[model samples]
Target: MDNKIRLFTGGTQPTSVGPFAVNEAEQVETRPGNRPSPRELHVTGTAEVSYPADRASVRLSVGNNKTTVNEVTSSVSRRLEYILQAVRQHGVREEDITVRKFLHRDQEVYHMNAEVTVTFSDFDQMEHACSVLLEKLDRSVSVGQPRFFHSAECLNRVRQSACVSAVENAQQKASRISQLLGQSLGAPTLVREDETREWRSHGEDDEEEDGGGGRRGQEAASTQVTPLPRIPSVTASSRVSVYFRMRDGNRKKY
Candidate 1:
């Protein structure tokens, strides 16, 4: 049996005995077959683009409460009309607005409650509608802002930019790595790609309240709106992946 000791950590010595004695030259030679050729390299590249959004969408909710479900629903329907009228008056096109959701549910404090949601296209128009409903209706109504958005063309363009960036990045990285290894980048022998989309929302979420910080009338007249208005901004992002091959010579394709 044999024994040997080597430094394992600060002020620490580890011992090896019997079959534990290590062979440095044998280990290096054994792994030579597994070592990668100097000319090969792998890298990831990325690209991004930002553009102003050209459109917006928003939904507004209006509701009423009463002793009975039917009565509450009828009351909400009546006042909601007025609310819609006010929104329309602000220049929101009829086609742009849609009834997204509506419901009549029982409330413990009030007995019956009704709610209606309207979606609009323009941000400015949505804001204006909310302002009028809060003022002209002279009652506290739930007001929500339009959601900003971008066009499909803009999204596609971003994707293409990302792809280009990824490929270029891979090429540059491969070139540097090959240079360090005493070789040159080569044409891509194997290639692959992937992508992703991300969306971020910007807005304040305000609570929906009845008439005046409290529930009141059963059948408030439906709110009415005017014409339509301007759009809002929406942003989208994409990511790309690429693979490149490296050779031992400078004759490489981009």
Candidate 2:
């Protein structure tokens, strides 16, 4: 028995040689087909805009506990009606108001609660309604502070303005950098928004309303003066990454 070992070498095949790689004579050829990527300047720009809140929402609730369910219900319902009337008298539409009632029993005593929520476009009117409701209602009624926020349209506009400003800022930066490098700034090749951020300047707390305004200890001479209301400001920001083509200052394009 004869055992012979055969070795096969693998390399570039002659028939598969590309036309751009080798000529007919197979002497090896090259073409200047692959072009280098165009020079570009990448810059990131950010912009933020603060917009005043345009809408306000106020929540008022009445809760009481009594031996009988009917007694508790009567107490809550009386104040609930007054709150609704006060809100409506200040030009609030019916659709902008919401009402809810809940009843439960704890041991021998029954508890009843009623909540009213009203949305207002005018802050002054909202304040007036709240003042009137507080004056007429008993200490059992709890009135929450007004929650201010921007409407959908207002928020959308603010974000759009911020994005546009960011792009403009990027263009300005690219132009300045190009000038400093002794190159001419060319048209933008790519633009993309990398991130967006939004925040409020003030508190965004939930319904933390209490029947009593405050503890007697917290009151001081400074607290005696009525402080002006502080409306929250909504801020929207945008960050954009931009790529602009780099052109030779001395060269002219045909």
Candidate 3:
């Protein structure tokens, strides 16, 4: 048997641990390959929120035909003024009222038309104003059905809440899936909204249509021929795609 002994005479010596020897210079060097990306689980989440209409708009119009433009305009103006007064009396703001006029000549008779669009925050006041106009003007003026919708602020909040709900749903789904697959759920790697949609649902009362010219007397009590003043709801939905880190469930993390 032959035996050999080695002596080290250097500024720095290599340290031996277990089966490998490492020096100060080798410790500062990075490993050859970059770390691999973590395992990811992909999922889609969807959520929707429904909110009742907050405000409404109604359009009213008056028209008259006469031999002279002045006469036709006068008649239309009187009715238009009366409509404005009624709308104002119901506590509607001035900025909420929009008025438009049109005058045209057809052969011998001159026709003049005036339209009033009013936005109302209070549904009761809107109903009352429409009722007054219909009851007084009757066949002379046409009142359109009130179009109900959510306000800007309300819509923004609904959309944001829906998005947040979708993300939370994604996290829950990912957690359950990872648990079932014998893996651990980690932080979300990526999240993005993939799709969004908004729609109005009238439910059973969708049979209602844009009302025509006003009906006589007691008919105005119904208020634009709608059924029972049903409050329509606006529904907003959001879909998101999320990527979450997945780790081996059996492996202990350092």
Highest TM-score against the true fold, candidate: 2
RMSD of candidates 1 onward, in order: 16.2, 15.9, 16.7
lDDT of each: 0.50, 0.73, 0.75
lDDT of 1 by residue, 64-149 (tens): 66666677667767767786677678776677666643454445423332333444445566666777777865554555544566
Global lDDT of model 1 = 0.50
Ranking of candidates on lDDT, top first: 3, 2, 1
Output the number of the lDDT-best candidate.
3
- Least well predicted 10-residue stretch by lDDT in candidate 1: 1-10
Summing lDDT over every window of 10 consecutive residues in candidate 2, give the lowest-scoring window.
1-10
lDDT of 3 by residue, 123-206 (tens): 999988898999999999998878887889989988888889888988788778878889877666456676788997773454
**Comparing 1 and 2 by TM-score, which wins?**
2
Q: Which ranges of candidate 2 are over 4 A from the true structure?
A: 1-39, 62-79, 103-113, 135-141, 149-158, 177-184, 202-229, 246-254
Sorted on TM-score, highest at the top, how do the candidates line up? 2, 3, 1
Q: TM-scores of the models, in the given order?
A: 0.39, 0.57, 0.55
Q: Mind giving the per-residue lDDT tens digits that candidate 2 earns over 81-185?
A: 888888899999999999999999999999998988889999889888888877887576788877787899999989888889888988888777878878777
Instruction: Please give the lDDT score at residue 241 for candidate 1.
Output: 30
Model 3: CA > 4 A from native: 1-44, 52-55, 65-72, 91-95, 104-111, 149-158, 173-187, 197-234, 243-254
